[model samples]
Target: MAYCAIAVIVVLMSCFFNRFRPLGKMLVIIALLLPQLSKAQKTVAPLVLNNEQLPVLPKEFYVAAVTDERDDRSAVAWLLPTTEATSITPQYKVDIKYGAQAAIKQFVNYAIPPDKALRPVIVRIKKLKLAESLLAGGRVEGKMEVALSFDLKRAYDNVHLIDYRTSSIYNRIEGQQYDVETLLRHTLEAGLIYFNTWINREADTNIKLAKGVKLIFTDYTEQPEGDTIYYSAKRPLRWEDFKAVPIGGKYEASVLPSIGYNERVEIINGIVNIHLAIKTYLPKSASWVRNGSSTNYSLNHEQRHFDIVKIIAERFKQKLMSEKLPVDNYDGYINVDYLEAFREMNIMQDQYDNETSHGTNSYAQQQWNEKIDKELGK
Candidate 1:
């Protein structure tokens, strides 16, 4: 019995040791792979550009005017400096009028997943009304108006009335603070929806065909004689191509914020006035990508640039139409103070880029201008 007991004990101990050894080895392997796994997880594929992403811009038929603080007057209400509305437009109000529409359009782009099916996503905005007056000291002291703006020519069967609302009153207070941040946020939301509605109206026909914005290829040659670089789009852009491409997205689709290009422009004005040649450049990592990947953010950034430029160009043309100016030649196109516009656009783009927390330098601005000077026979 004693011999048998010793045998059983030795066998059990060997089995236990064998099991623990494998577990220990597994733990070491996991420790070794943890860092590599983390790095691999961070690797993202580049965005794929397809026909669907191409932006289709409106022609001479489409025109828009945005006169901030316009002369449209309704019922007049005055508030003393001591007593002003503490609130801006209500969150629900803005959401109903414009926010919901913008949100819906964004959701449609990505297609709300099955898990999000129950959640109500904004698709389009129709009617907006002032539910209640934002009163000051229990008295009506401000004019809060919402105007529905739409591109009459482009909007189709399902017309989304993009609302332009304001929360301002003839207040005796010169600089009265009335929930300014909240007001601004709502204003921005309204602006985005209004702009996108116009873009959607213009782009709806082409959106189905567009996979992504087609990049404008550039050709650059160093001129040794002039000590300059000549640049142009590899292919010339004609007005007829507007109908062939997709133009915008849902929710502020017409414009996108940028940094590199903005910084380049700033560098020019800070030193010397210069021209600019603009085209999309592919990142090295992106050159290999053939399919769309969320990880590949560069492709998305470039697409955004293309989309914004398309919208701006359309708006520029619209402005020209209003002025009864020709939109045919390079001189006419360049006549608009595009430098100032680029700066404003850059500010918006930089803010958006900063929010993404991506480390990208804003030097596209500097190179673009130098390239343009070469085209101008400088």
Candidate 2:
């Protein structure tokens, strides 16, 4: 209105001065209209997405951040249709008040309060667009589309949990712009409600939401008929299993054995279940007997070395089963326990060799054999 008034005054003055200087009047009119033309060509007014229209609900997640990732970040909507009248035609750009990210953050917070004691999630606004088309009988049709992805925020990273996308079409009298906000608000509400329902249904079973850890230990018993002998009460080591050439040592015979485990991890009902396959084994190629010294007593001494490895493996399982393991670092804890068990095995092997004098002392050797058999539950 102010511009119109200024134009009218300028035109009146130009007419009054036309006879005195015609070029001056034309220049004054052009000068007066240029500013108005510039203002019209500038960006159109922005539409505010009011959050009050969004209805609150019981939600399982709170919005941590809202990111606008649309290809055309200049505007969230286009209010005016072009003369070509096609869905892809460019129109007057209309932006959300403040910005899309800020406005959506407000909208989500209004619907699901920030103070809610719930899971924290980031919302990626992949698409948020409103377009209008001129319809017959002086009416207009509007389409609003929204695509969003939800991510769970962990300590150092984020996990993509779910995605939501929806589009709505509505009809309104030409120039009735309020429908845009209504549709947008309903779309956002629908997204939030969908997520709430999804989480309620999936919270118990989704691996991404698992909160605790569990362990299931299984003894590895699948041994093929081969040179490697896995420890079993039914399959005691025999002298033939010692096939390696004896190294020049004071001991009559020697055996090489160790303990190890393989782990398989799974998440069920929001718990991380670690399945461990524990094994104690010896390879015939690594165990040897000296010539003319493969007596039952010497063999028993070597077998005790293998038995000590089995005992340590059992102890390793017990150590883990008796304690609560943290979900985030359970592997590290298992490794520490394994290293400790390995060290214990070496110490016990050395002690047995020293006390029995490498099977030389019959009384001490008998005492050691009894201790090994008792521990092995013979």
Best by lDDT: 2
Which residue pairs clash in candidate 2?
A: none
Error of 2 at 45 (Å): 5.3
Worst 10 residues of 1 by lDDT: 45-54
What is residue 199's positional error in candidate 2, in angstroms? Answer: 2.2
Candidate 1's TM-score: 0.18
lDDT tens readout by residue for model 2, 1-378 = 545866786777677775767667576767877765555533356666676533445545778889898898898777653222444445777787888899889888877777447778899999999877777776667788899998987776688899999988877664344455667777888998888789878877776766778889887776465877888878888999999998986888888899998899887877888999998989899988888987887888888888899989989988999888766567889999999999999999899889988779889989988888898783
lDDT of 1: 0.33
All models, RMSD in angstroms: 34.7, 7.9
Cα deviation at 68, candidate 2, in Å, is: 3.5
Local error of candidate 1 at residue 126 (angstroms):
17
Model 1 per-residue lDDT at 254:
21
**lDDT, candidates in the order shown:** 0.33, 0.80
Residue 139, model 1: lDDT of 49
Cα RMSD (Å) between model 2 and the true structure? 7.9
